[model samples]
Target chain A: MDIVVENLVKRYGNVEAVKGISFSVKHGETFGFLGPNGAGKTTTIYILTTILKPTSGRAIVAGYDVVREPHNVRRHIGVVFQDPSLDDNLTGYENLYIHGKLYGLNNTLLKERIAEVLKFVELYEFKDKCVKSYSGGMRRRLEIARAMLHVPRILFLDEPTLGLDPQTRIHIWDYIKRLKDEHGVTIFLTTHYMEEAEILCNRVAIIDRGKIIALGSPDELKSIIGNDIIYVRVDNNIDVCSKLSIDGIQSCKTIDGETIAIQVRKASEAIPEILRYLEKAEIKVKEVSYRRPSLNDVFIHLTGREIRDSGGGFIDIVRMRHRVR
Target chain B: MMESMYIMIYRQLKRFIRAKSRVVGMILNNILWLVFFGLGWAYTLRGPIASALFRGLDYLAFLLPGIFTTSIFQASFMGGISVIWDKQFGFLKEVLVAPTPRSLTILGRAIGDALVSVVNGLIMLSLGFMLTSHLNPLALPIILVIGLMVALGFTSMGIAIASTMRSPEGFQLIVGLLTLPTTLLSGAMFPLSNAPYWMQLAALVLPLTYAVDLIRFHLVGISFLSSVYWWLTPEIELLLLVIISVILIFIAIEMFKRTTIE
Candidate 1:
């Protein structure tokens, strides 16, 4: 493992931000920390990058203990924070140049690396313009350039495409994949976007309330539930689990208001059985559907609620209040 | 370590030079002061008090050095504004995460502000020379060195305060509150000879007083050293200023190390 965190604990006043979370990232692999808002993902990144000290437990990055040898850890890791960190007064080229100097790169190598990284992020032409003038996407690209200047062994990106437009977000995802494929740099990323993690990550750990709820490859986690999910809409708010006669059905769950989710071996067999039961009861079904379980479904199964909704109870109330107001 | 420090210092100096408005503001401030002197005290009395206070031994000449010192002091306090801006913009976190030593970052910013103050001091010196024929060209380098030391000392103090303060508005308010008293008591705006006993006592506690006294001694030959027994020698005042600067630097470094920005 290139990075290992054992029982990491961090607290702010009365709130325990991280409660003894433990995980590790292997070298040359993309590891995703998937979580919703306020789930201690950022705090974990802070500890791993040596920006904040853990109240207890141990974190080692690139073979150096974060607490005892933070400088060494810093040298091996590159980070793109959730917020942009470029100096508005300086040009993009100058920003990368100064960051290279901080890493003690020689002038020739620094210039070469800056050019290469700029081209990698496709910001070569805008290098001379002041960062304040850059668009949000352009600034983000520049930030990626700055982080890659030193060719660090590992790259940590926190919510890399949190608020980016879909097109720009896809572009960033491609850039990240290229970094891992070409340079062989290990990547540790945290994001709320499940599709991103499903596509990019070799392995992922679902974190909630400062604890790892589950950890595995996407396929492995999906296998734990079943192969396919049969979604049936029951009529008249009846109990579908008791009425439906479907074999190989692992469990039945309800979602939203009318949809009943069932995990079964074969969707074709389950759909016919469900139809037959409804026909015998002479009930008019609202709808029927079948699909594989996504990361969102896996998250719901592990946490007993949707990932975004788990801690967004307050946000729901605020929205409801606003709608009423 | 010193090489890295120098690099940090160079970056700061570059930023200061590039800020054209700041340079213009400094020059305009000195010119405004010169205009005040021309209108009020350019030609007054002729005696020891006049020599020491108004015009005999180059009264504006005497006043110029103090103004130079005050400008540097004000520049030091103004450096805190950059730190506050950095916090607001998220650049502070970027700098903090870098492999560079934390002390070097604070020192680099303080030195950057001090570099601007040095430029402002030189500009004031030029204005004084242009307006008065009694200016000594031979003492230029010595005066510049003293100006830098004074700037460094004051800038260190400012960095200490900046690292602890949360907002730019709050920092500016504190700077404004402390600026006039420190400047007046330290003989930057006036001579401390006829000052109240409490003011004189207050002056002794500040590093700027020693700086102003030293610059006044060199430019106008008014010996605050003879008047005050404690800082009667150049060597003693220089040593005291250096010691205070080191203490403030350590405090600033510690503050940088402990603070975490999101």
Candidate 2:
């Protein structure tokens, strides 16, 4: 295992940010924590990176205990923080050079690594420009380059493409894929974007309310919600949903006052049975639609709420700042 | 460990050099004080009473050491504001997560800021040296040494304060409250001899007073505190400054260790 977290918990005063979560990552594998904002993803990353101490339990990164042997862990792992951490006063090259030196890289090797990483991130032409002058995407790319300068065994990226344009985000994703493919680096990423997790990670842990509610490969997790979803709009959703325990229906949920979503083996076979059951129950069906289950459906199936709906409140924003910054 | 320290110091130097307006502003502010305040006061105090207070040396020479030491103190203390900047901008995380010892970060910052402070002091010293005939050219090296010590002590003090602050405005406010009184009480603008007993007592405890007196002794062949405490020799004063600097450096390092992300 490259990283092992066992029964880890972190509390800030009265709030438990990370509540007794445990997971492990294999060597050279790309793993991800998929969650909404303020779901303890950043807090967990901080503990594993040895920047924040855990309230209880333990985490071992790169075969070293995070609390007892943080220096060793730090030497072996590289991190790209959720926020921009580069020195805006320095040029892109200077930032990388300083990072390389802090990691105790010798001058000749440091220079070579700087050049290679900068080129890898496609920022070689902007090496001499001050980071303050670089655009947001450029800054993030530079930060990624700086993190990879020493060629650490494990890399942690927190919300790597948050608040970025779609094109820039895909570009960053490409660089991240290259890092794992070419360098054989074990990547541990935390992101709220479902597609980012589905596309980048070999496996993912779905965290919500400070706990990993589901963990598996994206396909495996999606399968947990059943292979297909049937969204049926009816005059009486609760009544129809209560009557949806027919043979083909795997699970049933009332989405709203007028709509209920049904999960089953196959929507083609399940929809006709669900409609007949609703008609037999004297419920008037308004509309019916079926589609393949995505990660969003899995999240709603498990948590009973959309992943994006749990964030964006004023208090959530404050709590997020407290946990991450 | 040493590599981290060197890298931090190198970063500070690079920042100082890149911020050209800041360097020019520091030098210009001190020069304005010397040209207007020093020259103006010198003309008003040309008689016997002024001569007795300054110990028969020109008033500009007496004020020279005070200005030099004050600029170093100001520059060094202001250096701590960078700690707050690092916190606000998120760069502190990078330093904190590095494998190097935590203390080395503050140490490197103090030394780096101290070097910049000394350079600023030297510019003021050189300009003042040309305006006054009482300063000896050979005393320049000794003055530089004294300024460096003062710079380190106050730079450490500044970093300590900054580590606890969250915003630049708050740090600036605290620096304002601190720098004005320390400068005034240390007798950087006037002779402490004719001041009240309380003011003299305050001056005696300030490290800046010792730094000014030592530099003044080398430049104009006199010490202000000698009249008050005849037993407080130059060697003892320098040793006291060294002790104070070391203590402040340790305190700064300890404070930095407690700095949280929030």
Candidate 3:
């Protein structure tokens, strides 16, 4: 194993941010922590990266205990935090130069690696421009390039595509994928974006409220929810779901206030029975849609809530931390 | 460890040079103070009693060394604001997670600010030399050494305070509150010998008071404390500043080690 975490826990005053969660990643594997905002994903990453100490527990990274050998773990891992860590006042090349120096790269090797990583992230042409002038995607790409400058064995990315457009997100995903394939680097990432986790990670632990509620591969997790999903939009979803009882339907969950998603073995057979039952019960359905089970469906099935709705509070906390009371 | 220090200092100097407005503004502020306050005091203190009060040297010559201490103190202390900036902007996270120890990071930042502060002090001294002829040109090297020590001492103190603070505005306010008392009590603006026992006692503990007296001794061959205590000599004062700066650097590192990404 490249990473072994056993009963890791962290607390802030009375609040338990990470509640004794334990998991591991094999060598050169892509692993992810999937959770909503403030669900302790970043806390776990912080502890593993040795940036934040765990209140109690043990995490070993690159065969070194995090608490006892933080510097060793740091030397072996690269991290791209959820927030932008680049110095906006410095040029892209300058930022990379300093980071390389921090890692004790000699001047010649540092210069060579800076060029190579900048080229890898496609930011070589703009290396001379200050980061303040770079667009959001450009800044993120530069951060990734900086993190990759030392070429560590493992990389930790916290919400790598957050607040970025879909096109930019796809571009970043391509870089991450190439890093894994070309360097055999083990990747441990935390994100609330279901597509991000599904596309990049081989195995994921679904965390909520400081606990891993479910853990598996995308297909295995999706299999936990039935084959098909029927999404119902109603004026009173809770009332409507309570009245409908159909055989093919495995479970009914009110995803949001007005939408109730029903997991079923076969949508074609279950849809008609569900509609008929809703009609006979005198509950008016505004709209109905059906699709194959997605990771979002799995989350909704397991938690009765959408991750997107609860996925945004972390950014607010970042802003709040910057403000003076 | 040395590599980490070099990078941290490199980043600080890079930012210092890039901010053209800050560079221009700081120099301009010092020049205005030198012209208005330096000349105004020179004119006001030209009488027989006032001349005796200035230890028989020109008032501008006496005040120049003090101005050097003030500018260096202000600039070096203000340099700590970068810690709050790094914390706010998230670059501190990158530094903390690097393989190097935390103390090296704080020490590098302090040394970087010290260098910048020394440069700023030299500029003010050069400007003062142009306005006054009483200073000995040969004393420049000794003056430079004392100036660098004062800069390092105050810069480390600034970093120590900033590492514990989160808000830049709050740090600025606290530094402002500190700068007033330190400048006023340090004999920078006036002779502490004529003051009351309590105020003189207050001035004795300030690192800037020792810095001002030492720099004045080199620049004008006068020492206010030579009559007060035989052992409080220039050599001993320099040693005291060194101890204070080293202690402050250690404290800054301890504070930085406790800082988290919360």
Candidate 4:
């Protein structure tokens, strides 16, 4: 492993921000720290990048202790913060040039490297323009380019595409893939987007409330609950809890009056059995389909909350108020 | 370590030179002070105090060096506002996470402000020459050196305060409160010799006092320190200033290390 964190603990005043979390990333692998808001994902990144010291335990990046050898750790890692860090007053090229110089690049090589990184992010044409003139997406690309200017062994990106549009987010993903494939750089990224984690990460650690709840590949994590999910929609409101009390159904819950998601050991074997029971119960099923379980399901199964809530709570409230009326 | 320091200094100097608006703002500020205050006083008070203040030199000659050094003081004192902004904008994180030493980071920023102070001082000196023919080539270099020292020390103080400030607005409040007292106490606008005893005492406590005294000594041959007490002049003040600057730089480094978001 190129990065190892053991029982890491960070506290802010009376609050324990990162409560005894531990994970490791191998050399030249893309690792994702999956978590929701205030889940200590950024706190972990800050500790690994040597921007924040661990209050207890230890972190080693590229064989240098983050606390003892911060300078060495800094030398080996490149970081793109969650916030924009570029100098708004300077041109994009000048910003990169300064970053390169700070990292000890000679003037001649700094110029060359600036051009190379700008091309990598596809911002070479606008390199001479001040950053203030660039859009948010453009500035983000520039920040990513600046972080990679030094060719670090490990690149840490904290929510790299948080506020970017869908198209730009996908473009940044492609750039990240190229960086890892061509340069063989280890990437550690944090994101709340399940698809981002599923697409980019070879392995992931799901963190919530400053604790790692699950750790595995995308397929492996989905396998925690089951292989496939049976999605059913009924025409009328019914008690899903009562309907779900049938055999061969591993677990089931009402998504709404029209939709219910069920997990089973084998959807091929269980669906037929489930349909027979529903028919015997005189339940009118409008739609049914068998599909692989997504990270959202895994998250919902583990955290008891939807990864992305789809207005279910609001709809429920409105239904209650309407019934009263 | 030295090579890293050199790289940091070079990067800082480059940023200082590239920001044209900052340079223009500093020049405009110096010009306004000269026109409104320096020239205004000369025109209104043609009394002996004003003439004696200038000595045999032109009025601008005496006022120019004071204004130049004061400009340097103002620029350096306010320079750390950028550091506060950097913290707010997240650029400070980039710099803090670099392989460079923390003290070098503080020194590099101070050097950046020092460079600006030098440039602004030279522009004011040049403008003074154009407005008046009182040219003392020998005294010019001395005034420049003193201005640089004062600027460097004050920039260190700014960084020290900024390192402790949580926000840019907090930094502005502190800078504003400190700048007025320091400026008035240093006698940047008037002679301190005839000022009230308590005011003189307050002026003596400020670094700008030594700065203004050094400029006055070079320009008008009026030494705040008598010949018998020549050793107690700016040498002591310079040493004290350097010591205070070193301590403040150390504090800033410690704050940087502690406050960096991990």
By TM-score, the best candidate is 3
Off by over 4 Å in 3: A309-325
Ranked by TM-score from best down, the candidates are 3, 2, 1, 4
Evaluated on chain B only, candidate 3 has a TM-score of 0.96
Off by over 4 Å in 4: A227-243, A253-261, A264-291, A308-325, B1-7, B10-18, B49-59, B224-240
Docking quality band of candidate 3, CAPRI definitions: high
List the lowest-lDDT window of 10 residues for candidate 2 chain A.
A309-318
Better of 3 and 4 by DockQ: 3
The clash tally of candidate 3 reads 0
DockQ of 2: 0.82
Error of 3 at B206 (Å): 1.1
Model 4, backbone clash pairs (residues 3+ apart or across chains), number: 1
Ranking 2 against 4 by DockQ, winner: 2
Each model's DockQ score? 0.50, 0.82, 0.87, 0.48
lDDT of 3 by residue, A1-325 (tens): 9999988889999999999998989999999999889999999999999988899989999999999999899999999999999898999999999899899899999989999999999999999999999999999999899888998988999999998888999999999999989989999999988888899999999998899989999889988875888877775635666767767667777655677777888888888888888888777887777888767777777787668632323322323443655
Which residue pairs come into collision in candidate 3? none
Whole-model lDDT per candidate: 0.80, 0.87, 0.86, 0.78
Q: B38-127 in candidate 3: lDDT tens per residue?
A: 999888888789888887887899889888988889899998898889989999999999999888887888888888888888888889
**Residue pairs in collision within model 1:** none
lDDT tens per residue, model 2, B23-59: 8898789889988999999898899988888889878
